[model samples]
Target: MIRGRFTIYLTLLALSVIFMLGFFKQMFVMDVHPYNKDPAPRGKEYSKDGDFDWGTAVKYNPKQKLLLKDTVENILHPIAPEFRIGDALPDTVVRQIHIATSWRSGSTFLGDLLNHNMGTFYSFEPLHFESLSMSTERRLDLMNNIFKCNFHNKEVIGWMKHASKGENNFLFQRNFRSFKICENLLPGKVSCYMDKFQSPICSMSPIRVIKTVRFRVKLAEEFLKNDKDFPHFKMVVLVRDPRGTMHSRSHHSWCSGEECINSTVVCENLEKDAQSAYQLAKKYPGKVYLLRYEDICMNPYEEVKSLFEFLKLPRSKGLDNFIQKHMFGKESKKHPYSTFRKSDNIYMEWRKTVDMGYIEKIQKDCSIPMKTLGYHSFSSPFDRDNFTISVLSKASESIWPKNLS
Candidate 1:
C-alpha cells in the first residue's frame, strides 16, 4: 500500500514538471510575431483605475539601425557644386579649356601654348574619340563640378586636398590631371567619341575655342541643328594647304584607311572643310577667325599675339616668353614634333609622296569645292581641257616636297 502511494505521488510530480516546461517553451520559443503585427510598443497598458503592466517593446534590429545610420550619412553629405552662372566665378574664370580637334592638327602645340599662359587650365583631347550619348546638360554639370574641384587653381589646390575623400583625394596633384587625360576618363564617359554639344559648362567660359579639322562642315551642321545659348562664342578655323594636310595625314599613324589615301575623296573632304570654314566666317563674321596653318607656323608670335588680342585676353609678358621659347630653335623641343613640325620646306610634302594618279583624281573631285573657296579654277589658263587635273598635277609636283625626286 505504501509503495503504491509513493509511486503515484512521484508520477504526479513528473507530470507537473513536463507540463510547466512545455507551456514555457510554447510561449518563449514557438510563438512568432507576425510580419503585419502592430508596430506600436507593447510595454504597458493603463486603465481608468491607473493600473500599469510592463512587456517587451518594439525596437529595430542592430543591422537595421546601422543601415539607417548610413542612409542618413549619405543624405547629409554635400555633393560637389556644378558650374553655374552668377556663382562666384572661381578665382580663375577659365577653369578648364577643351582643345577639340581631329588628330595630328597643331592642337597639342596650341594646348602647350595655352598651358604656358597663367590662369588657363588645359585638358588635352578631353572630348575627342568620345561618344555623345550623355545629355549635354549632364555633361556640362559634371564638367563644371570637376572644374570647380580640379581646376589647378593656385589657391584651390590646398582646399581640394582637405575636401577630397577616397579616389578624389589623389586628384589634387598637378600630375593627376595628366593621368586623367591619358586615361581618357572624360571621353570614356561618352564611350570615346563626341556626338553632340549641349553643355552649359562649355558656354560658361568667357572664351571657348573648338579646334577642328576635316569635319568642319559637319560641325557647322551640328551647331545649326542644336539650340545653343552662346551668342558671342567664336570658332578659330585653322587650315593648312590641302597638299600639306594630305602629306601629314598620310604618314600619321592616327590617320587610317580612307583618310590615309590622298584620293579624290580626301580632296573633296578638304575642300568641304575649307568651304565650311569660309561659310562660317561669312555667317558669323566677327566671331570666326580663319587661321592658315602655314601662316601661323611661319609667324607664330605675330599670329598668336593677334589671336590673344582677338580673344580679348590680356597678352602678358609670360605669353611673349612662351611664344619665343616655342617658336624658334631647339627650345621648341618641348613641342611634340610628330604633330607640330614647323618645317617651312615640308609644308607641301604631299606633292612628292602622293602618286600622280591620286593627285589627278583628287583634283577632279576637289575642283568645284576649291573654286567655291576662291582657289583659281582649273578651267582657266592653268589648263584648257582638263584644267583641274593639269593644275593640281603641276601644283602637286611643284609644291609638295614629299613628291620631289
Candidate 2:
C-alpha cells in the first residue's frame, strides 16, 4: 500500500513539473541573438541609352530575395516570434547620403526635401564654412574625414564641433550653434550637456545627410570605394540646364562676380558638372543618383518617390503635402531665396531672362553637353521653350537620367 501510494505521488509531481515547464515556455520568448544580418535589396543598373530610369528600380530588388527567404522560414516554423523594439535596430542599415551639386541648381529645394525625412541629420553647406580658404587636396582630405565621421582635420573639424547657445561666437559660425558640449561625455543622452543642440538621432534612423554645393561629385569617389566603412556614403549629383543654371547664377551674383555674359562660362561649368555626375553614376551603380532640377520641378511626386526609395526612407505625408504645397497645384508657397516662377515655366525661364545674343554662343559652346543631356540644341530660344513644353507634357521622362552615358 505504501509503495503504490509513493508511486502515485511521484507520477503526480512529475506531471506537475512538466505542466509548469510547458506553461513557462508558452509565456515567454527568449531571443538569444537580436540582430538580423539579412541585407535589403538594392536598385539594379541598366543601360537606357545613358539615362537612369525607373525600369531597373521597378523590377530588381534585393529585398525581394530576403522577403522570400523570410516567408519560407516562417512557413517552415508556423510560430511567429514576438519582437522587441530595442534590439531590432540591427536589422536595418543606416545610410549616409551626400548631395553633390553646383551653384544655383535648385539645391535648396532638394536640401529642404531631404531635410524633411524622419531621423535625417541634415546639414546645409557644411563646407561653406571652409573650402575657399583651403587648398584643393587639403579640402578634399578634410571632406574625406567628415564623411568618414572621424574628426581628424583640426581646422575644419573645429568648425563642426564648437556649438553655442546664442549666435555662436565660435570660429566655425553655426556648427555647434545651440549646444555647449560637456567637458567630459558619455555614450548616450546622459552625457549630453545641452538641449537646443540635442538632435533626435537614434539607432533606427541612423542617416547623416550633408547637402553641399561645395564638393564636386568627382571628389567623392574615394568614399564609394569602401564597401565596409562604418558610415557608408552615397552621393546624388544635382544638375540643371546651364541656360537656367547660369541665369540663376547671374541673378544670385554667383559667377565670379564679373559679368557672366558669355555662354562659354555656362558651357564650361556645365561640362565639368555633367562629367562629374555622369562618371559617378556610371562607376557606382547604386551609390550615385543623378537628379535633375528640372525633373524635380516637373514631376515632384515621382522624382521624390524615386529619391526616397533610393534613400530607403518610407513615404511620409508631410513630404507629400510639402510637394503638393510647393511643386503642385496652380500656386506654390514662394521660397524666400527663390524667385516667383511657375514650376513648368521656371526650367525654361532662361529663354525670357537671358540675352538673345548669348543663345548662339551657348549653342556653339554647349551643344555637346546639351545634346548628351537630351537638351535640344536650339536654333533659337523659341525652340528651347517649345522643347520645355514638350518635355513637361510628359514629366515622366527625365533629361538628366542617371544612366546618361
Candidate 3:
C-alpha cells in the first residue's frame, strides 16, 4: 500500500510541474496584436504618428520626441560663443545638477521646486538617449562635459550652442501641437513641462537640473561611471513605495495595451534600483539625497524645506504654499491615468491590498533587500520569518474577510 501511494504522489507531482510550466508559458508568451483595420501612416518605427489613430495610439503618446530631437540637434550644431575676434573668453561659471528617478516618482515636483530657486533650470530626461538612439554613451559624455564648463572641445561646444537656440522653442511647439492633436493623450491638463520650463520663471534660473525618469538605474550609473572628470555635479534620487508605484504603473501599462502585473519584473527591477540608489547615496553623502514620495506627501512643507536646503537654494516665497496646494491629500481623487494615485492614500497599503499568498511570494523572493531597507526585523514574532505571515494574518482577519463575504 505504501509503495502504491508513493508512486501516485510522484506521478501527481510530475503532472503538476508540467501544468504550471505550460500555464506560465502561455501567460507570458501569448501576443495580442491591436486590430486597426485602416492602419495609420507609419513614421519611424516607434516615432510619432502624424495622422492620429484615436483608438490604438492614445497611450503611446510621443510628445517627448520633439524634445529629444531638439536635444540631439543642440549637441550636433552648437553655436560659437560671441566674443570679439581677439577678446578673452568670458569667465562664466555654470553648475549642473542631475535629478534621477524611476518614472512617476515625483521627480517633476522636485524639479519644479528647484526651478523656482536661483541657479536651477530643468532638463527633462536627457539620459533617455541611450535607449532612444545609437551612440548614446558618446553623446551623453559630450553633453555632460559641455554643461560642466570643462568642454574644451570647441567643435562640440559650437555644435551645442547652435543646437540650443531654436531647438528649445521647436520642442515646445512640437509638444504643444501634439497635445492639440490628441487632447486625451496625456492625462494632466497642464503639461508641467510647459508650465515650468517654458515660462519667464525658467529664464531666471542659472544652474541646470536634468530631470530623468528612466525605469533602469544603469543609465545614470553608466553616465556617472564614465564622466569621472566632471565636477560639482549633484544627483538627487526620488523614490516611492513600490506598492503604490506598481499600482500606478499597472494602469498606464493597461492603457498602452501592455501587461503590468502579469510579470514580476518591475518589482524585481525596483528592488535592484532601490539598492543602487542607496549605495549611491552612501558613496556620495553630501552630493546625493534620496527623497521618498510618501514622506513628501505626508509633510510637503517640511520635505520641501529640507530639499531646498540640500540644493543650497533659499526659501523662496510661496514655496510652502505651492507644495501644500499640490500635495496628495484626502480630498484628491484617483487620477484616471494612474491607479497608484488611489494607492497613495493608504499609508503602508501594500499590507492591506496585496494578496497574502502573493505577499508571501514577494517576501520570499525579495526578503534580503527588503530587510536592508528597514522593512524587516531580526527578533520578535514579526521578524523577517514571520513578517509577511503576520501581515497576512492581520489582513485575513480585518481586510480580506469582508471582501470574501
Candidate 4:
C-alpha cells in the first residue's frame, strides 16, 4: 500500500512538471521565434514554365505584371541641412521620412509621389503587422527596426513577411524592386531568400520613406523624441478636412467605429495632432512639415514643388510624369484604394453627397480642428452647396494657426 501511494504521487508530480515545461517552451518560442512554422517543401523538378496564374486582387498601377520589373535607379541627392535632426548625419545614413496621418487622408497619394523619386525605399505601413494586443512600445520598436532596415531581427522578419506578403503585396508596387526580384526568383518556393535580400537593398537606398496612417502625430513625435537611433528623420503630418475624411471613410466598410468615422473622435485626434505638429515644427524647424490634403488637391504642382524643396530632394522627371499620369489621367474602374485620382475636384464631391444633418454635426463636433486647420464650416445648405465658395480658408496657406505658440 505504501509503495502504491508513493508511485501515484510520483506520477502526478511528473505530469505537472511536463505541463509546466511545455508552457514555458511555448512562451519562449512566441517571444523569440514567432514564425517557427516551416514552409512546405517544393518539388525538386520545379520550373517557371507553367501558366501559373499570378494571384488575383492586384491593386497597383503596374497592372498584369505579376513579376515586377527591376528598374530601380539609385540617385544620390544632397540632404538639406535644415532637415537634419541635430548633428550632421553620416554619409552612410539615409534620409528617414515618416508620413504621419489618419486613414482617408491623401497620404497614399503623397507617399506614392515621394516613392516615385529614384533612390527612395518606401515602406508602406509597417504597422499593418500591428495587433491590438501589442503595447505602444512594441509598435514603436517595430517601426524603429523596420525604418533602420533591420530585417534580420527575428521578430521583425516575421513582421516584414506579414506586411509585404499575401494581400499586402502592394509593397512591391512602386519601390522594393529588389524584394520583387527575390520573390520572383523561386516563383513558389521560400528558397528565394527574401529575408537575406531586403535589408541590403533598403539600406543602400539614399532615402527611405515610411508612410503610415496607423501612427498618430503624437506617437510620431514621441518616436522622434525618444529614438536616438535615427538622425536624418523628417516627419510630414498630413491632415484632411474632417468632412472629406469622414466621407471617404464611409466608402470602406472596414473603416468604421469611433476611431474611424466618428466626427467627434476624428476631430479630437486631428486637434491633438495639430497641436503636436505645431510644437514639433517649432521644436524641429525644417525637420517637421505639416501638409494639408486640401492644399495638395488645390494646387498639386505648387505643393509638390514646395514639398520636394522642403526635403531638399531634387524634382525628378519620374515624379512629374507620375503626377501627370495618376492625378490628371483618364478615369477608369479602379481599386477603391488606388492613388489614381482622375480629377482634383473629386475631393469636393463630398459637399454634394454628405447630408446636411451630418454636415451640421461634423461642423459642430469638428469646429475646433476646422478653425485651427483653416477649414470653413457651413452654417446652411446654401453655404455648403455653393460651388463658388471654397471650404478652404486662407489661413491654411501657412500650415500653422496664427495663435500656435
- Which candidate comes out best when scored by TM-score? 4
Clashes of each: 13, 11, 10, 0
Better of 3 and 4 by TM-score: 4
Q: Residue 176 lDDT in model 3? A: 30
Ranking the candidates on lDDT from highest down gives: 4, 2, 3, 1
Q: List the candidate 1 regions with Cα displacement exceeding 4 Å.
A: 1-102, 131-215, 218-228, 259-262, 331-343, 349-360, 369-405
What tens digits encode model 3's per-residue C-alpha lDDT throughout 50-131?
3223223222324433433353345322432231111212223233567767655666566666655533445544433343
For residues 1-405, write the lDDT of model 4, one tens digit per residue: 533332333333233223222222222111122234653332222235421112221122233222222211111112221221112223334578899898888888898888877657788776767644467887787778767777777656766666555666655554644444444344432322344345645655557888877777877765566446666678888989899999989999887677887888888889999888987878766677888888887778888887787776767667777877788888522677788886568778899989999999998998888888888888899998998888887555565643331
For residues 99-183, write the lDDT of model 2, one tens digit per residue: 8777777887787677665444455565655545656687666555544444334643444443221233322221221112321
- Name every residue pair that clashes in candidate 4: none
- The number of residue pairs in model 4 that clash at the backbone is 0
lDDT against the true structure, each candidate = 0.40, 0.52, 0.43, 0.65
Task: State the lDDT at 235 in candidate 3.
Answer: 68
Q: State the lDDT of candidate 1 residue by residue for 190-296, as single tens digits.
A: 20111111111222223333332323343543343222433334455554555445556666575665644545666666666666655655554545455555555
Error of 3 at 286 (Å): 1.5
Q: Which candidate is the best by lDDT?
A: 4
lDDT of 2: 0.52
State candidate 1's TM-score: 0.48
